[model samples]
Target: MYRAHSTVATPSWFSIIAALVAVMLWSAAPLLAALAHTSSPLQLTALTLLAGALATLPLSRSVPMARLSKGWQASVWLGIPLLIFGAVSSYFVGMRLAPAAEAALITYTWPVVFVLLSQWSRLRTLRLSGVIGALIAFSGAALLLLPQALNDGLGGAANGYALALLAACCWALYSWLGQTAPVALTPLLPRLLLVACAIAAAASLLVEGSPKALSSEALLAGIALGLGPYGIAMVAWDKALRLGQASIVGSLAYGVPILAAALLVVAGMSVLDWRLPCAAILVVVGCCSAGRRDG
Candidate 1:
């Protein structure tokens, strides 16, 4: 949920290249899902967790995840499910409620959530610039949500937005809890447990209460969920976030919507739209301002 900033202080040639690569993938995540037609968040979540769990086998067995502290073990068990469910449920649900652009934009509110929570918890003092950035970002997010809000007259797409907001809440909580967790920056066992729980949850939800059978497309999409955001993305992000500024990571995360829009166009699922790119610019600006305040 919290993508960390690039932490290579000296900025070697490799670090510079890695930073660029990270930004590109980070930006592209939401678009990747839209392009993939990642419809069922639950299925996507389950597969991600399963994949993460599978990834854990070699590392856990070799490194012996058991060697970690009890506190870390508990954190992993708690945080992993939070990651899977929070991501899967909210992302898919938001996609259903609104356009991918809108969902992605809405979800970026996690930064604001983090800032607020930090202030409340005495982790940091809230600043005027941060408040202003939040307001501007909220206004821009509101504009994107306007269509969904209007569409509520037909169905409760507005309610879908609410659900999406709820998903954001889960993400915020996940990030915050993870910060306090006692494991190393990258904890394979805890991450594995979280993914395993998510996989079980996703499997149960997808397989049960069925009228239609599982489509091959959906199955593949679930695998993408497991592999993409849930698998590699988490590891990369955790490693980075552990070493960098959460605000910067949160801001950079907004790039996902724009990336998703571009990918959607390439896939011919959607047309090129200008609003999301514009919103992304605003998100980046806000993130920069917030990062400055924190720095």
Candidate 2:
């Protein structure tokens, strides 16, 4: 997705700083999500989306997100919101069964999925080398679930990782479609988030038996999650991608999961072990390999 260097300016210090800040905020998201003990993922998704909508109101005004050259306006009202609602809800749901680190690594598969989807659809041909690299990255995911699958059946134990994969795919599809965006999206963020919130809220009402009230701790964490990762991190990432060498800025994103995993380990929410680091290394290497000469 960061392959479009022509759209970005030369690297700058501010751009790098913005990228790092995105990394930090995003890395803290799961920690906050774990703390946000809602009755269901749908409720959490709605809350975070509502908070994100409020937080990005000023951003929507400051950023230029209208049609730059007008061909097709983005689906700020429907498709985009549906995708985001799916991604966020799935991620929140998946975080329950998997360790924070493992789930974090799983979502990072977005890069790999993004590369492959573009290659398959836009380019209409995927290189054998890229396919092999993608397989290797998928192997890392297998490493993550093998132990649990051994104890339970793959059907039950693999649910979390499967949902995580679904989340990654939804986000990947969103990114792929955005490559030809007729309008900028930065300014429409609030509306986008609000629409997503409505979807989540409706989903919660139907499936989860209505949205329950949040606890004080959950409320605070949800606010922080929205204002930081879902809100500011998104804005910062946009600026960084546009202002810096996109490749360099994107490389920094690979570290977000690692840092998030470390945070979980330090917090005693999870443990750092051979599985996570090795799996992460494989994922990054495979994704980088797949990116090379594929897009």
Candidate 3:
């Protein structure tokens, strides 16, 4: 993804709120998947992507035709389509084996990754606040995720960690490329999601044959995931990137793990503990630092 003119608009309340909306949707993902209990990861992936495609298709027309054409031209050569498929599919499969907190911590690194990639690609430079904030956020992530991983024994989650890393990398690349296209990739989000859906569906067909009949709850859960986290979250993220400073929006995402953990606890799938608040403070401080107007 060659750098385009800097795409991150000035920081704004709309961007911050949009990014926060994406975080909230993402926070619900683990809980939603647990409720769905869709038997096959691949099957679940395909279903959610299909739903995302359907949800985004109607929204595509909202963009002006001229903007859409520009975005499409910039996007076609960016490899964003592959990044989209990789990001969504890997995260779905990885969560099947990873702890909620650990998974959240790992996936949330995309912000830092995005900032670094953006800087390196000349899309944006890493500001001092971004560096300091990234370090602080990662410290918090380590605080939350390290003890848990050690206690659970990393061996059991080896595959999950690998997949999670892949997911993070893919997502960072996707977001960076989106900005590089200077948001020409946005109008194409539906198409990219649809491409991911097609690939996942084909893979599921070959590997698992056909999906098993799902419980009604599971079916509903799948739809909810598609329309919320996998679908609208992507849109919200694009809006955030378009409206906010990249580092700030990316850093704001540090809250995802905290919110996700809280959601799991409320759902009775996890326990509330001291580390949650401590990590929350660190993450919040980091987000504030990164988002400072002067930065």
Candidate 4:
């Protein structure tokens, strides 16, 4: 049975660094979306995946291919690849279709999803605080969607919000499934990413044909996303989670929406909407509450 506990021996400094890395990785989504304005979402996704795979290639060299291949079987290669492809594709498409801030807000709902799923599976007992927090968090999510719901309805930004939620669900499912995988994730990640890259490439070719010429800025942004958020950041995040208190690291995840929204505003991609701050506060508080340890 799963039991909740914190690693008291883990240094605070390392946890802080890991938390910072996670914040950066989370914020990278909207930034990547902003940078992808000139390119097809599919193509951009493909390029970023390819770049991530290439960046991580050296790290995977020492990992035995046979062992890695065995891990793929554990993940049920078909399901894992499909999940990653769906998650990335939906996220990119949602970003393309809606405001970066809104998309980021929607995608950041995965923590709530995780909590709910764990409670549902009896992996963790839901405390009163968790229930209340889930309600507050979901309320914030609803508030974020209100603008689109009122204005364009399902025909416009609603579609993007829906897609973002879909992306969140896919991510949550993948995370849950990863827990039961036969092989540990650290060694499995590089290979999993390679499969994701292949899926993205195939999808891009089918939808967008050959990759077209991109502006210097877009190219740089894509490269940054590949190497930073999708590549090195992932490795750091995994290490941090493994070494740090899960609750503390999970609480830090709530920072993503705020960071992403602020960055988008600074980039002039989004206005400082009143709803954003209010929703962010609620979401962060809710997530923190949900992650609290039961006495």
Each candidate: what lDDT? 0.58, 0.78, 0.70, 0.72
Model 3, 192-293: lDDT tens digits are 778778888888899889778878887888889899987888778777877888777776566676787788879986667888657666765664554444
Error of model 4, residue 9, in angstroms: 3.4
The candidate maximizing TM-score is: 2
| Model 1 misplaced regions, further than 4 Å | 5-8, 35-40, 55-76, 123-125, 147-154, 189-213, 238-254
Which of the two, 1 or 2, has more lDDT?
2
Instruction: Score candidate 4 by lDDT.
Output: 0.72
lDDT of 1 by residue, 170-194 (tens): 7776666655555443445445556
The true-versus-predicted C-alpha distance at residue 264 of model 4, in Å, is 0.5
Q: What is the C-alpha local distance difference test score of candidate 2?
A: 0.78
lDDT of 4 by residue, 51-158 (tens): 777766655643443655655665656677677778878888998777778777777777667666766676556777778778887788888787767877756677
Q: Give the TM-score of candidate 2.
A: 0.89
Question: Of 1 and 4, which scores higher on lDDT?
Answer: 4
Q: Pick the candidate with the highest lDDT.
A: 2
Q: For candidate 4, report its TM-score.
A: 0.86
Candidate 1, after superposition: displacement of residue 96 in Å? 1.7
lDDT ranking, high to low: 2, 4, 3, 1
Report the Cα lDDT for residue 141, model 2.
80
For residue 295, model 4's alpha carbon misses the true position, in angstroms, by 4.8
TM, every model: 0.76, 0.89, 0.77, 0.86
